[model samples]
Target: MSKGLKGKLVLAISSRALFDLSESHQVYLTQGIEAYRQYQIEHEDEVLEPGEAFPLVKKLLSFNASLGRDRVEVVLVSRNSADTGLRVFNSIQHYELAISRAAFSGGRNPHPYLNAFGCDLFLSTHADDVRSALDAGFAAATILAGGTRRAQSNELRIAFDGDAVLFSDEAERVYQAGGIEAFQVLERESARSPLRGGPFKGFLEALNLLQREFPDDACPIRTALVTARSAPAHERVIRTLRDWDIRLDESLFLGGLDKSAFLEAFAADVFFDDQAGHCERARQVVATGHVPHGISNPLRDLPAD
Candidate 1:
């Protein structure tokens, strides 16, 4: 294990998540691994287009330039074998992204290497990999094929769902079993008590630490909490953030309203939610990551939305 990456914010992203490899992936799906390997070799010189997470990765890497040190690292974790992964490296080089580390598992599960890389976050198009990473206590999301609307401002705006993504799904469990009435009652009763941190808590804390490096007025990174909770239920979330000493640039308690327009209004680069329905709607306006976590995601073997 390399102790040098201890203090840095590290991200492990899949090749499919980092670059647009849908065409090549289709080759693999229709044909077999041998055909896919040949296709990649034939197109080794061609550059792969950016995927949903590419812009976010660029913004993340930009922090190093502002801080004048390698404070953030993005490592490529893919199922493609090294021989077939040459195109991915070529694409990274073409984009001039400062990502040199990689773990090509040759179609095996690569979540185990995330711990070795000391990854705080993991993004992948593969749902199973994301679920495995989350199961291993790392913040992970399945990157969806979302809209192409990138934030116009230089600021990198990231949005997250409250319940499974940031806080534990305890209240969500109530909502799932009982109804919204029961969930609201639970929130009102536990208003003062802070909610437990979820898988993304550590990732959020790391972002906060990075945000502190710059002046608050001029920080390039902005985060928002976009949830369905409203009014009385929101009290617990506020108190939980206070308890954790974490701050968000914006908070939206939509009260079960559609989140697509609000996310577009916020000009978010990416939004994360645990619900497939929310992810399906939000992705229409902004890049979305489906977080398969908490009680909501009981079917682990289901495909990504």
Candidate 2:
């Protein structure tokens, strides 16, 4: 089958994720929508600061020039009305981003349009929108606002957790119910069985397609698997990826070690993990996206609000 977006890796990012909107968001929360609208209009000439996902987006777009073709597409998906979204567009012009497409939903949820955009990934600051996209089986993450450091390197390094992000949460459910010992036992026994694909599997596959466009030694994109599994449990993950025919450049099996420092050493532009605690720690060093998926996410265990 022919790919959507002409075989480009399409990403739909919320305006708040592309540019910092803390001040404007505070205005809306404290004053009201009218004041917030006026504030955006007043500052329409001012270019907004880059948000958490800006660096990643920039790196993704750089592929077009390097590869001599349009290999990636980034679309703006914002909750702002067109009138109030002028500043965002102006900022894009100021930054010279190649993004020419957008969806201004006014105040409505924008996840419904993700399918129309053929988005492989959705990054947003709004948790509700992220959850909605994930529910619809799209690779989505809530961009964390806590990261202070950014990668300065040209290589785009992306790290992902194994269970629940790349592979299904079946192992995670066992861990949550039976602890690490049982989890290891299950993994040991299931070493020959291929794990089910998680939501991010498709996203990783899309990324792998792009990576293959360049020669192995010259590829600009680097991917890593930063997982907590180690030793006896590692065989299944290796077999699983082999089964899927996906190749990750680096794989770190930390075996319950804190992933922040290792992720820092990797100099990742962005890291995705289903565990909130891992994301929280990771954001202190690198841009982090909380997947909010699988058994690790507490919200999934709770009743819908």
Candidate 3:
């Protein structure tokens, strides 16, 4: 018989995203892979400090305690070969994380395996991997390392941006090519039509399913739509979510106000946005991931120089 990942709420994470492997990553950058492998082997027993995505991962796994083990699974999927990954396993053991499965993809990009693993989300610090994962049609984000580490709260709070994130970049492309007024006008006109879902739609649907596991308002997870859209423009967002049959606990229309303060007030465990600028500020207040999608990711137009 063969094992499969078909029905579980899967999170395929990179080793670096699960633990603090910065020192070893530096060695790989400056010294080389051999030196990095040797270093990880030597430090096999050292408990790693939590990385940016640690709290979120831990909390996601916590859902299993109530939802049953079959409901959630976290796979340690990364480019690290088995030889250099012992330290990561050791750290997982030391911290007592519930993750057990792994796929050591060596030098190859692991994004392809997201579907193989039925991954609802794929998070890594590697921008290339993230981009590849998104391109491959998985809900993916680049974990921003060295952010203010968020302590695991009793309730899981996830925040997401509107354009290029929860909703498609259709209106955002208009905003980027035209201007704020143009964007607002188009959004207002399309208010009744309901914007299309973005890349995280499946991930959010998975989360919504998890929220349903609990009866009534007792679900431990709460979500927020913290976006820059304001006024009549906000109508499309609301209609879009309704059209998708998705419900968010809170929606903050900042109209381009800095989102850090609002996210802080919401106490988000993790925040996702397509822009590096929003993630920079969000990470300062909470754990943040850069969803490198839509028109914002310029590498699509201009090759890496």
State each model's CA lDDT, in order.
Answer: 0.91, 0.91, 0.85
Count of clashes, each model: 0, 0, 0
Per-candidate TM-scores read 0.97, 0.96, 0.95
The TM-score-based order of candidates, best leading, equals 1, 2, 3
Task: For candidate 1, write residues 1-305 as lDDT tens digits.
Answer: 34337889998999999999999999999999999999999999999999989999999999999999999999999999999999999999999999999999999999999989999899999998898999989999999996666745568999999999999999999998999899989999999999999989999999999999999889999999999999889999999999999999999999999999999888999998999889889889899999999877887545543
**What is the C-alpha lDDT profile of model 2 across 117-143, one tens digit per residue?**
888999999888888899998999999
Clashes in model 1: which pairs? none
For TM-score, candidate 1 versus 2, the one ahead is 1
Q: 1-305 in candidate 3: lDDT tens per residue?
A: 11257666889999988888888889999999899889989988888898888888888888888766667899999899988888898889888998888999997998777777788999898889888988888889888864665554678899999888887899989988999889888977888998888999889998888888877567889999999988989888888888889878899999889999999888888899998888877777788889989998888532221
Q: TM-score for model 3? A: 0.95
Minimal lDDT window, size 10, model 3? 296-305
Q: Model 1, residue 92: what's the lDDT?
A: 98
| lDDT of prediction 3 | 0.85
